[model samples]
Target: MVAPRKYPLELRERAVRMYRTSDPRPQIKRLAVDLGVHPEALRGWIRQAEADRGERDDRLATAEKEELAQLRREVKELRRANEILRTASAFFAGQLDPTRPR
Candidate 1:
């Protein structure tokens, strides 16, 4: 069995671009044959990359929406707590200074 060779990322990106372009099938096949790799392998790489790009975009949008929701809840709770504290402070102040109250 032949040992599999490691390919660089730039090479893979180039291969994917070539596979995705409007080149004729025969030309693509000849390029793959010259590179000693299957034409289908390059085509599959392009397809998988496209799928992954869309999936990543969707996940990023979902995460941002979740984070925004959590932040809004936090702001609401904090405002409620602050209002309660202010009300209590006013009540105590009135009770302590009723003699010369303004």
Candidate 2:
């Protein structure tokens, strides 16, 4: 399940738009203060917005990150199931060996 966002989408979008349009491109820290958001958080939001708009390509977009996370989880679950099957096979093989001690 996705966690609830601490800040609303509207606010994030507004912050990014303001940052982009501001004269001289105001510093992240100062803009964050004006917007009542954490500087680092605002910076990350701006970066993500830019990436989504194709203004930046250095980082993964939100959808890509979510997809990557989902794929990673599926891989982890498959690995765990594979390990369980291997152990079960080993145990069953041992049980079927007639020469093995009871």
The best candidate in terms of lDDT = 2
List where candidate 2 sits over 4 angstroms from the true fold.
Answer: 1-4
| Residue 89 lDDT in candidate 1 | 96
Per-residue accuracy of model 1 over 15-95 as CA lDDT, tens digit each: 767666745644656767776677777655565666556744423353465698889999999999999999999898888
Query: Each model's C-alpha lDDT?
Result: 0.69, 0.93
Q: Number of the top candidate by TM-score?
A: 2
Instruction: Mark the regions of model 1 whose C-alpha exceeds 4 Å error after superposition.
Output: 1-60
Per-residue lDDT of candidate 2, residues 55-86 (tens digit)? 89899988888999999999999999999999
For each candidate in turn, the TM-score is 0.40, 0.80
